[model samples]
Target: MAEPARRRPMRADARRNRDRIVAAAQEVFAADGARASLEEIARRAGVGSATLHRHFPTRRSLLDVVFHDRVEALCAKAGEHADRREPGDALVAWLGDLNVYAAASHGLVSSLLRDGPDADLLKRNDDCQAMITAAAGELLDRAQRAGAARPGVRVEDLLALVSALSLAAEQRDDDEGRANRLLDIAVNGVLLPR
Candidate 1:
């Protein structure tokens, strides 16, 4: 098996610059979509274009970082939810959190799909999906083992169901309310009968 690539620690200033650029890029992308200008992002980040380019050479690279960071954060939240004693409640809570992540990810995901992804973006996308799937699988397993969830529920099924909810929520004026309602429906459907 291939060893995972090690990330070298960045110098303090470089790390700060990178963080600023990513934050700016996310805001710009949210406001202007993926075609948002890199120079504009650098300006918003309080960094020069050269520095932005040094950290993220391509628009796709910046998007990849933003997407990966969000997924990693979701994974962390899943870990927290999994630690809860009530397995069903944990799964439902994690899925609710996942719904929020999905909503945040909607714009970037749409842009990435509309534009052809580069090799690096595709690889990162695959890795992010794998991480999310693994987290969901663990939570689902716990719920099922506890007899809190119905038999035969799969992680992909939950993901797809939540994706639909997220899409529906995106179209609503009260997205948070709609998203939570949709997630509640999904959780109810998954729960085992008494």
Candidate 2:
């Protein structure tokens, strides 16, 4: 396996500039999604456009950094939820959180799913899907083993369902609420008792 490339630590002022840019980018992205302007981000960060470009040469690069932490946190949340709740409860709660995240993030998730120009740059560096699958798989396994979930549920299919439901919800006026509602419907399908 190839060893990951090491990053040199940033200089103090450069570090500050980068941190400010990330903060600005997060706000702008929340309000504007992936098409949020780089120049506007620089302006908000109180940095020159050149500084923003210097720190993040491409929009994809900046986005990778901006969303990376959130993905990590989501994976971590799965573990925490697993520990605190029953297996089925933890899976449902984490899926709810994932639904909200996907609905809110908007364009960023679509960008990550793209297989065009940015694919080459993101393929190895961005492991959001893998990380999520690992976390989700553990939860699903526990639920299935405990007989609280169906044995055939696959992590990939569950994630895809969350993404699709969230995308549909994003078109609604009540984004998160709609996403949660849709997820609950999926989670609890109508059945006739045998």
lDDT of each: 0.85, 0.81
Q: What is the TM-score of each candidate against the true structure?
A: 0.86, 0.78
**lDDT comparing candidate 1 with the true structure:** 0.85
Where model 2 places Cα greater than 4 Å from the true spot, the runs are 1-8, 11-13, 109-126, 174-176, 189-194
Model 2: lowest-lDDT 10 consecutive positions? 185-194
User: CA lDDT of 117 in candidate 1?
Assistant: 54
Name the lDDT value of residue 117 in candidate 2.
55
lDDT of 2 at 58: 89
